[model samples]
Target: MRFALLATTMLAGSALLASCATKEAPVPVTPAAVVEAPAPAPEPAKPAPQLGAFGFDEAGMDKGVSPGDSFYNYANGTWAKNTPIPSDRSNYGMFTVLADLSQKRTQGILEEVKANPNSKIGVAYSTYLDTGTIESKGLAPIQPWLNQVKGLKSKAGYAALLAQADRNGVSIPFGSYVGQDDKNPEVYALNLSQSGLGMPDRDYYLSADAKQVANRAAYEKHLTNVLTLAGEPNAAARAKAILAYETEIARVHWTRVDSRDATKTYNKMTLAELTKKAPGFDFGGYFTGIGAKVDYVLVSQPSAVTGIAKLIRSTPIAVLKDQLLVRSLDRFSAVLPDAFDKENFSFYGTTLSGTPEQQARWKRATDWTAGALEDEVSKIYVAKYYPPETKAVMDEMIKNIIAAMGRRIDALEWMSPETKVKAHAKLAAFTPKIGYPDRWRDYSDLNIVSGDALGNVIRANNWAHEENVNHLGKPLQRWEWGMTPMEVNAYANFGMVEIVFPAAILQPPFFDPNADPAVNYGGIGAVIGHELSHHFDDQGAKYDASGTLTDWWTPADVAAFKARTDALVAQYDLYEPLPGMHVKGALTLGENVGDLAGLTVAYDAYRHSLGGKAAPVIGGYSGDQRFYLGWAQVWRRNFREPAMRQRILTDPHSPSEYRAAVVRNLDPWYAAFAPEAGQKLFLQPDQRVRIW
Candidate 1:
């Protein structure tokens, strides 16, 4: 996956800027389930049968669904039909199963901590229990923050308020993160970008589509409920005013496409220069509050950030206070009272994401504790689940795949030799962080107590903020990790110029150690290829071997790459998940590039693994057939219609339906399935994209 570096705002993205993603978050909404959502997941007592190395998943397949018609359904049709999406989830598939398994282990750790709180896990566990006290406290926890907001009578104070909010990990007018300077790629620097919206994407405010209009209406009601609960006056009218402010902010934002371009967003300026360019907000005070030491900051989307200063200044003081109060309530409501929690779920869970019910409190608390004390929980997770052998095996697999990518780059006809030399240098320098970070993050300073739910989270957030910024003026910690061992996701860091596969993602169906080479190559093998390919994707390609965001490509090679990416974009744009709702081709171009490259290289590695011997037939499938199936099984998803529709609009990844279609771009897929003429998936040989 193209790793999105940690930023001040990861809250809402209608599209992904390559190399990053926000941890899952909920937005306020209404209770409008068109089709009744799935029921809560049933807990089975017995262990599931271990997937075999070579045995076919006969039950997983739909015999009648032809591979040529739709390979995703052909491989996963039976499972999709039989399995219901859990009531607490918007979608469920292979990844969800792995996540649920990891959650089960994480819960065991938290439950132990809850019973016996101590130095390491005590704070996170006690904070989890604090939610029980939230009802009795009854908005008292946020009263201090509310009073502070109300007292912000001057625009000068807005900057400080944002600084304070940043300590608690909340998004305000803008967000900042400590990352490598894109130009220097050696020392850590503070990066700021446009933010402060209550909605998930800027387009939610700008789009005239019916779904956006209805969801926006639901959001207005959601804002009203949250604000009214917080004891604010004129909740409905306040929501209207807030929406307009966000809409204007959205209008000025660099489009999602522009945001994805590294060359476009990397505008570095001195603090003094920034003040002159975007003069209303107090950078001097803001920098002081945040303890930023950098002489220069990278202002991503400068126009949008500058526009934010204008919005903050032009808006009335009362509206600004209301904005802070309402967003705070929306953000913290899940931990507040039953009413607040339920209301939060009504919209974000049901209306927007199509989850029918909220998860159990313990489950929700489990997530919070995990976030607050990730490394602490991960210490236990690694011991209980991830063995040393797994990491060793993963290391071997990564080497094979990287070697495969190296060969492909050497053979690229479109790339000039000059670009290939630099690309090769990058491949040689490519680092892989598998299983866990060499260094574990300390949460000693993050305060957590039994009764103060809000304070505990704020302190935790502050600890996180301080930890991130503390790296300033120091060498970049190349061994540092972005995601924890317990996180069931992978990332490719453009800053560190590395690929990370967390311990949790190392399990089957992504990586079945016991499975045959073909199976492993198809599943986790594709994921590894995907992350490596990200380094060469539109965004990652701009960065040099040292991780600087500098172009090393010859002009002729750059044009050829764009021509291919343009073709890839047009191919994906044709896929429509909902009426009039096609996936944003340009918005998802980087990810599409990664997906195409990852799967292609994975197939090549699998062939290389064969070492000239013909592939063996496993059950009824050939090696090639199982390879495609392995890839297909990874993306086997069952999504609620509304959730599917929303993801089509917002997620940088193409819909699961089309993610399976990534196989269509590969030549082996046609050869394996032999997609004949007139088949829905059939593409002429000349039309196939072979960019890897």
Candidate 2:
């Protein structure tokens, strides 16, 4: 959900992977979770309804609760208390509603494809849906790759195998891509990073915590069980060797906090220098085999690339090959036979995410179809669901929000005039990619056959690899989007100095054409402000408006800015979402700053929207109250304990409960609903942090 630079997940979509964490599979896909809503003042309320004017229900509020005390509870307490997470989903909330809507719509499109079979969308959708064929064929499809791994001997052969896997999309050993040059944002640069780990993160392998230690044992057993299922003769020994190899690789991995820092990680390297830096690895053959046409690459983790290469040279060829085999199995088990699916899900799903059951096959297959042919799927989706008028409205709102942020920057007291000038330029240069990309990804070369699910995926990955490689030395597609149109997510591409809100998020509680100006401003306005604030966050501040990663702040201004941010960090560090664990203030600083500043700017924009007129009360609440309620509705979420714990441990954003608590930073929120002391969320005037 952070800047989705060059990393690729299962569908090869744009992603921001943990620097050296297992890129192939993170703990589970991140789920939604909370913030600002109003408390009930002493008044006879109107007839309570299940939902409000739009889909954001006013009845979700717990009237008995106080706002300054716990706005999350006051706003979403009833919803949290009543909403049950779906059995198949580890977490559920506002995002899930939009996601389900998109999924259902996509399912209909795929179902049409299933009927047509000859159409382009149909061909892509049907590829992953031929489950009966998959179940009957069992491991026959991927067996060739496994057999190839079994016979791998020379280091060149191993490198070739890894490249082939990467090209074909079942890649396990570190991930590679071509992205914007951090130093020179206009040009495309190839990148390689640390990947190919069995567990979710390096901490799982190296942490001294007892729970993590036990999870490691379970992971090993899962690997052994999987290898044994694949008929490996010495499965137990191979598992041990594979674990040791991964552990060594993990040792050199960049920590999550360090990984989030763009300045520290972006290392431009020539192909020859890269070879020397990570000696013993055959990057030449790998690049040649993969058709990666580039002289230089943006190596995300130099130590990792070289360290894994060193591990490759020191470890026996068989063990290294076996690790590939195991990782391959883990990566593809979702589309493989039922046996593979059950085994893979048992650990990654049940043990890791704590969902009790797997989603139905159709849902999985449909989601795969959505991801696999997202360009085409998005095209169809836009034509059907997204209208031109909606885009026009979103564009207008984005412009308004930008104006609000610019006004805030012009008025900042801590930032020097020089820094403020740069900030204004950066904000003015901001490009809002609302709804979808101006240019679509070309999937023309990808061969999508009805029953060849594996073939379809491999070709899709190859298509992406080729596309990235071809971008070398070419001008950047500045208007290109990282997410598909149907995705229920938004991102701030710091390197591009742009903000993207996918078509899906533009609908519902996030943005509604029919909702009052206050509601729309509170929802999508906050999103716009959040992304805008990210530009001034610790990492984004390094990059100037032109998208170049250069310092634009005076030393004194930067120090003053950090001093304020440090207060924000310390405030969050005190939040205990789970017992015995605390939010990592340093890690989530950027996102926290985003939430805090975003809300502040959104509120300002809301008043600006009034054009100096009094805001009309709607739904028995005043305009300011409605604004806070709408903002809180944007974050409504419920998660299982396991998912909650996982999010706290790995996610850069604070927990949903804490995200809602971000209101404590703003004085206006306290003033709108005056709160006395002894409330759960009350903070002294000095305790509040202001960064904008």
lDDT of 1 at 451: 64
Candidate 2 ranges beyond 4 A from true positions? 1-50, 53-56
TM-score of each: 0.91, 0.90
TM-score for candidate 2, residues paired by index:
0.90
Tens-digit lDDT string for candidate 1 (1-692):
12244334223324322432556564544445334434545554333325744523657888698877888889888988999999889999888888888888888887766756465465556565665678888887778887988888788788888788777776787879988888888877888898877777787788888888998899889988888877777889998988888788888877778887898888989999899888789987788788787799899999998998888888887887787877777678766777888888898889888899888877777788888888888888888888788887888888989999999998999998888999999999989998997777766666677667777777877888888889998876787788888888898998778999999898887876557678789888999999999999989999889888876999998899988998889898898878888888998988889889998888888899899999888776889988888888888788998888778767788887688888887777888888887877777888877787
Give the residue spans of candidate 1 off by over 4 A. Answer: 1-49, 52-56
Q: What are the per-residue Cα lDDT tens digits for candidate 2 across 1-692?
A: 01234432333234444343665654664524222233533444333322477436777889789887788888899999999999999999999999999988988888876867667668766767777887888898899988888888687687888888887677566788888888988888777888878777888889887777888888888989999989888888888888888889889888788888898889988889998899888888888777777878888888878888888889898888888888788778876887888999999898878899998877887788777767788888888998778878877778888888899988988889998888888988988888877767767677777787776776776777777678777887786778988889888998888898889998768887667777778788898888888888888899998999987899999899889988988998998877877899988999999999898999998898889999876767788888877788878899887787678778899887788888877887887778888787888988779888
How much does each candidate deviate from the true structure in C-alpha RMSD?
18.4, 17.9
Native-to-model Cα distance after best TM-score fit, residue 659 in candidate 1, in Å = 1.2
